[model samples]
Target chain A: MSKSSFVAEAVKKYGQDRESLMPILQYVYEKKHYLSKEDMQEVAEALDLSSADVYGTASFYSFLDTKEKGEKIIRVCKSISCDLKNKEQIISAIESKLNIKNGQTTPDKKFTLLETNCLGWCHKGPAMLINDNVYTELTPEKAVAAIEENL
Target chain B: MSTDKLQKFKKRIDLIFSDVNWKEILDKALKTSADDIIKELIASCIRGRGGAGFPTGLKWKFAAQQKSDKKYVICNADEGEPGTFKDREILDKQAKKVFLGMAICAHTVGSDEGYIYLRGEYKFLVPQLEKELEEFHKELKAKKLDFKISIRLGSGAYVCGEETALIESMEGRRGEPRNKPPFPVVSGYLGKPTVVNNVETFVYTAMILKDGSKQFCELGTKDSRGSKVFSVSGDTPNPGIYELELGMTLDEFVELFGDGDTKAVQVGGASGFCVPRRKFKETIIGFEGIPTGGSMMLFNSSRSMYNVLHNFLDFFCEESCGQCTPCRVGCQQLLKGIVAVKAKEKPSKYLEDLKGMTETMKSSSKCGLGQSVPNCFNSIIDNFKEEVIY
Candidate 1:
């Protein structure tokens, strides 16, 4: 199915109730990487919610994206446990390797680097989640090598 | 001590990966009356393991008394607390026990439908958790049980861990918490009487039903019964899950998980108290002292106290729902105050002013996120004043 049709189908599957907004956004985000303005508008119309209502809920969450994102999103845990284990060095390594600072996407739009709260990998500190795969107990060298191999 | 020292500690209520007959417990719960189940829960003295140590039986009794056609039981799987990972382990391994716990809760509360508000980051665990749920449903069908459970994903919002905010998220709106006169027990999840319990709480309830409430009541201190599963991490050699009796002293815990150079321990995740080395011997890990939601992060001499406080403050600043002014402004002020002190831009007295601000946030903030956000900040700064200020 096409992207628009897929979103329409997801909206139908989740239902047109106001409570279906989150799931609809989630389904769209999964299918199309980030939530576009047009998609949000479509969802608002389908769920009988205003665009602002849909956008407000979407923006309140850190996972939902209002703008276009790269193919891969790298989230580094900057919580206390990871911080105690040199999270800074690991973040710096990713920046230098990707040639982009935190919260910035690469020039080619292949990767986006962002810092997040605990990813529940405290035992394995200095953890980073690239897309859906979690790499824990990371050193600077290992982080750089992992990103490079994927790149 | 080597990582092997972790084994020397006693394991109690956390039976995540253990093989057990959940069907036996379900059969027993099915045979028992709802009031009897609540009475047994009260006898067991099992409180909600979701950081707030509210009595589990009392919550059920209140919800059961309410007259409603549609009641609900919610499993708070949104384990987003920094330095906490025990719920994730439970969901990953022994998900059926969690489901059984929910079923027991539903049967006790007279609710046939349940929902697990899973955290968004654990989206990867969805396929596996759903598979487990499918099998569980098949078993329920075989046993002629009418209860059913569905999973709802939280969208990367920490505030959703709060019961009201979690309900709002379930309603598909912004995950902001509501005011409290009518708590979730009276009106929740589309304004129905709902009971929300943590993943560990549910598993423990199932265990209690299986082994008998008297067996559970006999385990811990008189006030705080049963064992707790702690997610031990940070500067420790063995950074993993440990299930222990609730009343164990911090000194004993430090001997087991702490490295030789341990300086402090952040008990109960970021929202919990930070215990300095001097107070480790006096502190207890149960309701009589500091109650935890299963996050025990240790700090060694090598770790900077200032950086730790900074990270926690930053997390609160970003995660706050911004609906309440106290939390919204208080978190920002605390974060800025700490930075100013570290840079000598403000006098050390600035911290004293921040302490007063934290008191306001503690009393006035809308939910637990804002209320307990100052815990680590105040404890770390007060305990390590020299390192934090100069």
Candidate 2:
């Protein structure tokens, strides 16, 4: 099915209510990996909200990506607990293995590494979330091995 | 001391996944009058476990008295507080009790629909939580209960942890906090009366119903009653969840969780205060001293006080919703000012000016995010002046 049709179907499931905007965006992101301008326009038409409104709401959240993104997103927790556990070592390992900075994606568009505030895994620090799966209690070596294995 | 001694010093509520008869409590709560339930909650003196410490009974009373046909019971499962993982554990193990508490609240407040605003980062737990909800729905159906609940996922915003901002996120807008006086109890969730309580608060509500309110009230201090689940992490040999009596001193807590080299403790999360080792003996963990929303992070002597304050300020800067001026600019200014001072580009006297700016941010900012952002900054600068300046 077309991406527009898929998003339109998702919007229809929640009806034309404005309150369904966040869920609809979430659905589109889940299906497409990132929200595009076209997706926002489609959602705007379906929900009777302006494109700017849809885009603004989408941009406000850290998870919803409007621009092009990789297939797998690796979010490193940069908050205090993870920081205390030397989260920088993990980030450095990923950078060395993937050859990209914290906010950069691989040249092949396979992976995107980003920094995020607390992933709620403070007890098991030095944590990172690759896509939806959480990998915690990470050492630099474990983080690199996990990324390489995924690749 | 060994870890066993530390374990013995703590109190465990055991309400979550305690094999309690939850269905019986739900049935009893359903049959009980709303007024009587509110009275029981009042008698228990249980407050909102979501860090605000607002009286849970008064919140229910306000929502129940709103005279609206449409009301809502929201379980604020958006556990975004850094170093606080107790809610995640509760929701994982005792989701049934959490839902039961919501149903009880809905029955009292005359609402039939509910929502759990689960955080975005914990989206991985959604399938498991939904499965639990499905089982709960079947049980509710068998009992012929009218209340139903649906899950809504947050999209990676920490400001949504605030009640008003959470309502906005549920409505599919930017997660910006709304103004008060028309609080959630009066105007919430599409301007209808809504009761939003923390995950732990609702679980405790169900537990209170299962055990009499008097028994629960007998546990803690006069001001802060009952047991609290704390998320302890950092510089501890065993870092995880612990349920303890509400009014334990920091000295006792340090003995249990703190390492020998522990220098300071962050009572709450990013928005909480920091207590140095010297003050730990006098500090209490309840409302009378420093009220926390279940975060107890220990920093050892090796950890720099300057870096700790810097990390928290950076978090506030990124998480602020930018709806209000003071919080938006104040956070950035504090972050920049601290960096400049540390770099020695700005004089140490400049910190006093920044401290005054924090006072303005606290008084004039839009929401709790702005108002409380200065807590760690003020506490750290005041307590560790030498470390911060030199």
Candidate 3:
């Protein structure tokens, strides 16, 4: 669904109460990959809120992106638990394979490289999250393979 | 039931419902005017219960002081400490209170957005919170309120419970602590001014705002005024959440649940101090205990202090966020020293090295995860030298 339609549906479901905008934005972003200005405006009107409120909500949450959408997302676990397990090596391995630095989306927009906090599986360590699914006990080869599989 | 057992159960149940007037809680949180809401919080003096004990009102004032067009509030529901479960209780029994507190905080901080970043194993709370949040949003919309909140779940890393790490995880990045020249108060979440508070800190705010600061202050100690919820697990008769005044002694707390079999009460969680039985008198519930605003697990003669320290070290070794070298590597070195000592590989000979590493971790680590990494071990060893030597 388009971002506008998603916002329209959200406004229909959760009309312009300023507080409902966060969840609405989260739902729309998850669905359309990014929240557009139109989506933000539609959300503002529905909640009887200003465009600023809608934009603030979107920018406040890391999960809700207002920028141009990426094709693929990469989240590495670089917290202590994962670090102890050699997450750095895995990060470099992915960087080498994709020929892109962390936080940069690939030229083709096929990938967005990012590091995630903990992601909760520290026992397994050296973990990475692709979109929502988590990949654990990752080595350089595993990191490359995981990226390739997603590609 | 014996009078003692009956009283124990009564105390436990009372904590969940005790003195907390639900109607007042709802009324105070549902204020139509932002000034009334901020006034209520200012009157509460509810400080952050997550160990720091900074006044909640002041924290809002700091973030609200900034003239940035965008601001944010984060509820640090990530209770990943080994023995802490109070966050789960507040989120479970008082999810509305948690949500309302977040709204009040946002309104007070001049932010239109809020997030409750909970640890992952709290899967049980997700659906419960989702339903509660759905209802809250409905009611809020019906009133045309402008702020909104959401629950973000964390997987399992204990360090993720730290504010910066929590922010990193929320941003879909690795849970490492950012340097503090720009604390979360200045730049957080999506690089916005954010205020992260514990579940108890927020819940208490709902009450304190409803009642007045003088009323909340009428309860605990002078410096630490308020009732604190303690888990009181390990070697206790009734191992559960207990609410007590800030000045309550550790012995008094132990007597409430420990049938006199208590050897030591691990005041605070694994990251807190290990007050030995002798120094029990020194342990008070509030700031003195370094509550971590978490549960209190007790240990008796059956558990060795040495073993407890060993296990806690293992947990830290495994839970560091890996960005800083001291904590990521120091934790492992401390654990290896413990193992070698256990294997009779060395005696107190390695104690100095471990102590040196512990000091380095306490002083140099980037985040709370690194700084607090050696707290439990240091407390145990410093207070109970004989235990480790043996």
Candidate 4:
């Protein structure tokens, strides 16, 4: 339940190197769903580093954040290629179906909707990333099914 | 999509790359006058399809004028930005065109060697491209040509997309941007003169050589000439690649996307300027009197401006390459301020700090990443101030 125990589970895979904190943080953030503040404190304490140090490394990247963890993070591709392909309908459908507007977490914290720029999959437009998995050629119906599967 | 227009366009392409033999294409293009090529290019007024809308011919002339025995022409295929994917499309679909284009640029610039710098994740695209290159190389070798080229894969670092950073990575260093002033046009790659261009830019060279600059210039606006390939994504129908003339307003573009059902469009990529719904019609994609070949569109109401911007800023914060104070430290501080504002945690205290830092980022920083990273912040604050300000 605490950050150290969470990290204790990770020590074997990540090793005890404080320098590995960023990589470890990335892994844990991906696994645990989000980088919790308490987890940041735990990482700092476990690595014998200051919380500011841990926070600095965590906050440095766009992928990691200290915000309250969401059940799902939807990064929709809004870059030019995807834009040409109609990413808007997918965003609106997903938002309406999820009952949460863009950038908002559901009341149950089942999802956090965010519109991400290009995931580099231009040929397949209207794409979204559910957690780390990329779902390409997405439609409004398909988006709902994908979220439901996660839920 | 009228048949006449489409037929005319296809006819133009067929007429251009008519000769299948690489040598024939090269010989025909080479014998064509550079002045004529420049003329056609200016007429087309095609903007550099790369992120920057710099005029392609002007850029070539600058590098061509600088007398250097070791000048290099680099094709930037390191497409790493999140929403952008047009470069890869060209590289994957019309690879022969890409190579043939590069060859023309090399010939025009009088460079003997060229390199195609691609992003690492493009693992699938590289091998296929390499095979095509081999065929082209073999044909050139058979023809007894002096020109040579090689491919360098970028290791998943967004910062390397910067010309200077790209030069560093090609030289086998960590992919971080270096100080400029001695731009790549002067000192680059192996400390030799280099002209780094987007994949589309080189591709256009083939067109210019084939068509003549004057003809090419005639396609787009008088100032911003040539056709632009926009990666249209987001809300609307037919979200795919659209090749349009320069000076096409965003409203016209959105209408092409299907109906008027749209919210915002993120022109350029992560480092590009964002035009809100209100200003979409007024903005025209172009360079210094030209259009950049790289136009990415982000659409739809499903996306919130706040989240899109936060994600962009966060990407900049992580990928600053840490080479300078403004970009390295300033990005982090700005991210913190964004988070604080979003959470409504001491919002006023961080707003001015964010503003001051953005001004510094724009004023200082070594390259485009540091300087333009602030644009993400500025656009969001100006366009989506209500969404961001708690």
Best by DockQ: 2
The candidate that wins on lDDT is: 2
State fnat for each of the candidate structures.
0.81, 0.93, 0.00, 0.24
Evaluating just chain A, the predictions reach TM-scores of 0.91, 0.94, 0.87, 0.89
Question: What is the C-alpha lDDT profile of model 4 across B305-369, one tens digit per residue?
Answer: 77767767777776788878988898888778777887888565576678888888889888788
**What lDDT tens digits, residue by residue, belong to model 2 across residues B172-197?**
89999998979999999999999999
> If scored against the real structure, what TM-score would every candidate get?
0.97, 0.98, 0.70, 0.71
Residue A87 error, candidate 2, Å: 0.6
Model 2 residue A33 distance off true place after TM-score fit, in angstroms: 1.8
lDDT of each model, Cα atoms only?
A: 0.89, 0.91, 0.71, 0.70
Cα lDDT tens digits for candidate 1, B94-186? 999999999999888899899999988888899999999999999888888888999999878999999999999989899999999698889
User: Model 1, residue A8: displacement in angstroms?
Assistant: 0.3
Point out where model 3 deviates above 4 Å. A1-151, B1-44
Per-residue accuracy of model 1 over A1-151 as CA lDDT, tens digit each: 1248756988879998877778888988877778988888888888888999989999999988898888788899998888888889999998998899999999899999999888998998889888777888999999988898788
Instruction: Provide the lDDT at A9 for model 4.
Output: 66
Q: If both were scored by DockQ, which would come out higher, candidate 1 or candidate 3? A: 1
Question: Candidate 1's error at B94, in angstroms?
Answer: 0.2
lDDT of 3 by residue, B1-390 (tens): 233753764563233334465445655566635566555566655567776677777677778777778888899987766556677777878788777777777767788888888775555568779998888877667666577897766655677778887887676445667888687878987888999999888777776667666777777776677677765555655655656667778777766766577777776666777777787777776764555565566777766677777767777777776778999899888888877876779887787779878888899999887788677878887877667777
Q: What's the residue-level lDDT of B261 in candidate 3? A: 72
Q: How close to the true structure is residue B269 of candidate 2, measured as C-alpha lDDT? A: 90
* DockQ score for candidate 2: 0.91
lDDT of 4 at A8: 66
